[model samples]
Target: MQKSKSFAKYADAEAFRAAMEDDVRRGRYHDPHQESRLFADVAVEWLHGKLDLKASTRSRYERELRVYVNPKWGAVPLRAITRNGIQQWVEGLTTGDYPAELPDGRSPRPLRPRSIRNIVKVVMGGVLEYAHDQRWIVENPIEKVTTPRSWIRTTTRCI
Candidate 1:
């Protein structure tokens, strides 16, 4: 198959072509067309493909996808989900910086670090990892994302 891309600078175009050739040689090339799939679609597919998850676990995964992941990433194409974007999303969760209206029609609120981590792990991790496995993306952006510390230790114990 042949693909064409336009770059404003010839050097940039050459660099991109060189990278593509190297990726192809190393068997790391991913078809650009697959990256257009929506995140919600991929997440649903990934969740459904897990046959061994406990009922409760599956329920939680679904909830996380609906409440957290989907609201932010549902309509976005897989190629647009970058590590920086994931990092910003995580920061927003911690800071209550989301839009006023979420999918469930409730106002956004800051989530605890532990809760944020679980959402990232169970929802983001599962979906992005699946995308990588499907060759929809060249790499899992979540691998580079870091969540905030879950909690701070208290210096003194309660009496």
Candidate 2:
């Protein structure tokens, strides 16, 4: 049976059963044993292998991964990262209730929702895509997550 990346680590048995149901609905499943690598290891390999990114973009992604994503999810097995966990993590970013303190030499500050979205897109999105391609997980969990919506404000000028 194949497993999707949305299966959460430490999830209850019922969650696994639900995931199996989801797999049947999707017409595919995941092998839990296939996801043995730590997320950090896969992310680093992907970062080094991507020759298409501009130096600045690559640097920014690396920094974001190191300062934010890694500290929280790096040690997790790729298959064990669930959509709910990701959503909660994203919410934590906006609520200033992050799962872990930033790694050494990084400062915590109020991050705008847009910034948080971008970090998730660039770091988590990229890593999960790579993981999916490697068949480490059946689907990219990032695709199932919801980032904060962008809000726009307009001021009316009196005539």
The per-candidate count of clashes, in order, stands at 0, 6
Clashing pairs in 1: none
After superposing candidate 2 on the true structure, give the runs of residues whose Cα lies further than 4 Å from its correct spot.
1-32, 99-107, 153-159
Q: Give lDDT per model, in order.
A: 0.87, 0.82
- Screening candidate 2 with a backbone cut-off below 3 angstroms (N, C-alpha, C), the clashing residue pairs are 1-30, 2-29, 2-30, 2-31, 3-29, 3-30
Question: How do all models score by TM-score?
Answer: 0.77, 0.72
The global Cα lDDT (0 to 1) of model 2 is: 0.82
Candidate 1 residue lDDT tens string, 96-156: 9864335556778898988889999657898999999888899999998999886678797
Q: State the lDDT of candidate 2 residue by residue for 1-159, as single tens digits.
A: 544445356566678789779986875775557687799999999898889999998998888888789888999988789888998888888877775547574656657978898888768898899988776788888897888888988999999
Best by lDDT: 1
